[model samples]
Target: MLVGVLSDIHANRIALDAVLDDMPDVDAMVCAGDVVGYNPWPAECVDEMRSHDVPTVMGNHDRAVVTETGFGGNGMADAGVRYALDVLDDDRIEWLAGLPESRYCFDGRVRIVHGHPDDPNRYTYPSLFSARLLGEEDVLIMGHTHVQAHERFDEGIVLNPGSVGQPRDGEPTAAYALVDLEAMTVSERRVEYDIESVIEEIEAVGLPEATGARLRKGR
Candidate 1:
């Protein structure tokens, strides 16, 4: 089966649309987390994911919005989450809140999480491959760094599809990955979108201007 893996969508509908358009048809798709945060169009992003019935794990931003917890970052980061919460309706909020912190897919051959396997909010770098964390899973999928990575370890394989909405890998294009389980191959892909359009939306919606500017720099 071919699986499209995405993460850190961050509510940019344009980027999400571009990635979806660029991606090849797959049997299923999975998002690591951060479906809503740091950008405008949170509702649209969430709605699109729902329409596709994609199985997603709860991201730190999603948890913060649902639990009314502070992001503990700069004022802009806090504002972004607040804006996302304000724009999302109760049903969407409930859906975000109800998402599992982690999940096992393909009959436990794949493990999906927003951050670390032990902690959903922890920022576990891809460089730190741990057999203890992976356990017996054949593949481990995680996001949260906003960087695309595919690593092979003796214990298992680790894949991060990067940020679909807010990429920070010094590349403006939206990022994702395709995993062919049957073939045991993985391919990373990037799709360019109209960055200015999303930036305009961010400014129009009164989200932090830096949020939009970062897209241009992919920082």
Candidate 2:
């Protein structure tokens, strides 16, 4: 089966749309999470994900937006997350609250999570920690940290499609991944969008200035 993996869509509809436009057709989708926080349209992003039928895990930022837990960092994420916490409707919050931290044993080989296996709170990357934990599974995908890359680990393969909304790697394009489980191959991909338009929306929505700036640079 081919699975499209996406994550960290911090409510930037433009970026999300760009990634979706570029995404190859696949049998299923697994999102690493953070459907909200640090962007212009949290609700719209959530709706888009729902419409796409993407199966997602709860990200730390997504949790913070719902519970007001203040777990995310105090960087560009602070303002938009705080606003989402204040404005999100109860039903949407409940939807986020019901999301799991991880999904395992799906095909008895592929696994998915918002962060590392042992601790979702810890910021683990494919280049750093994923290589060790991927095991012999067909695929292990995750998002957080907003960086995009794929690593062939000791046991299997680890893929980070990157951040669909808040990329911090100095690139404006949205990031994602395509995985073919039958072939055991993964590819990182990016799609360009109207960065300035999203920035204007952020400003219009009164999100943090830093958040707006990061969208252009992908940082």
Candidate 3:
């Protein structure tokens, strides 16, 4: 079975749409988290994921939106989270709240989480925790650092699809991953969209201009 793995959507409809359009047919799809937060289209992005019926894990930003636990400070990132919380309707908020912090899929062969296996808010990077986190599962997928990566360990494989909305790996393109369960292989993928359009929308909506500027730089 082919599985499309995505995470850190961060509410950018343009980037999400582009990734969805580029994604190939798969037996299933899963999102690691951060479905909402940052960018300007919180509702639209959540609605899109719901429409597709993708099983998603909760990220720190999604938690902030539902719990009203602000990210702190007056920085653009915090402002984006506040804006996302304010704009997301009750249904979207509930949906974000209902998401699990972690999940096992493919009959427990694949484990999915937003951050680390132990802590959903903690970031997990390649070669850092795979040895400690890997177990009997055939694959473990996570996202949080906004950097695309694929790692293998004696225990299993760890994959990060990167950030679908805000990529901090110096690449503006949306990042994702494809897992071939039957083949036991995983591949990282990137899709380019109209960053300018998203930036314009962010500016038009009065969100921090830094939010849009980050997309241009992929910082």
Candidate 4:
């Protein structure tokens, strides 16, 4: 089976739309998390994931929304969370609250986590991936650093599909991955979206301009 892997889809509807449009057909889809936060359309992003029934693990930003926590004085992040809380209704918030920190999917062939296996809040970049992190799953998927990278080990595969909305890896495109389970292969992907339109929407919604600016820089 083939699966489309996604992560850090931080609430940018335009970018999300672009990613979906560009993705190839797959048997299933999964998210590393942060389905909400850092953009104007938190409610829409959440709804998109729900509509597709994407099995997602709780991301740090998703946790922030449910727990009413913040990065502590990070105005950009705080604004996104507050906006999500304001726009998302109880049912959606409940769904976010219900997201597991980690999960085994595809019948134990894959493990999904927002960050690290040991700590969901920790950023496990591709460089840090090693056989040591692999337990029994064929693949260990992590998100949170907004970087697109993967490593193949004799034991298994470890990867971050990158950020769909708020990419910080200096690549100004939506990032994702296609994992071929039967083939034991991974394809890193990027999609171009309407950043200017999203920036305009960000301004319209009264979010910090830096939030939009970072999208252009992919910072």
Candidate that scores best on lDDT: 4
The lDDT of model 4 is 0.93
Candidate number that wins on lDDT, 2 or 3: 3
Flag regions of model 4 displaced more than 4 Å. Answer: none
Number of backbone collisions per candidate: 0, 2, 0, 0
Report lDDT per candidate: 0.88, 0.80, 0.88, 0.93
Model 3, residue 136: distance off in Å is: 2.7
Candidate No. with top TM-score = 4
Error of 3 at 71 (Å): 1.2
TM-scores for every predicted model: 0.96, 0.92, 0.96, 0.98
Model 2 worst lDDT run, 10 consecutive residues: 125-134
Residue-wise C-alpha lDDT for candidate 4, range 1-219, written one tens digit per residue: 999999999999999999999998999999999999989988898899999999999999999999988667899999999888889999999999999999999999999999899999897877788989988999999999999999999999998999999899999899999999999999999999999999999999999999999899999
lDDT of 2 by residue, 1-219 (tens): 888888998888888888888887888888998999888788888888778777889998898876776645585667877777776788778888888898864566778888887778777754585556765566777788788888775578877788988787778788888888777888888888898998898788777777787667777
lDDT of 3 at 41: 89
lDDT, model 4, position 41 = 89
Error of 1 at 214 (Å): 0.9
lDDT of 3 by residue, 6-93 (tens): 9999989999999999989899999999998878888998998899898899998899888888777757768778898778778889
| lDDT measured at residue 11 in model 4 versus the true structure, 0 to 100 | 92
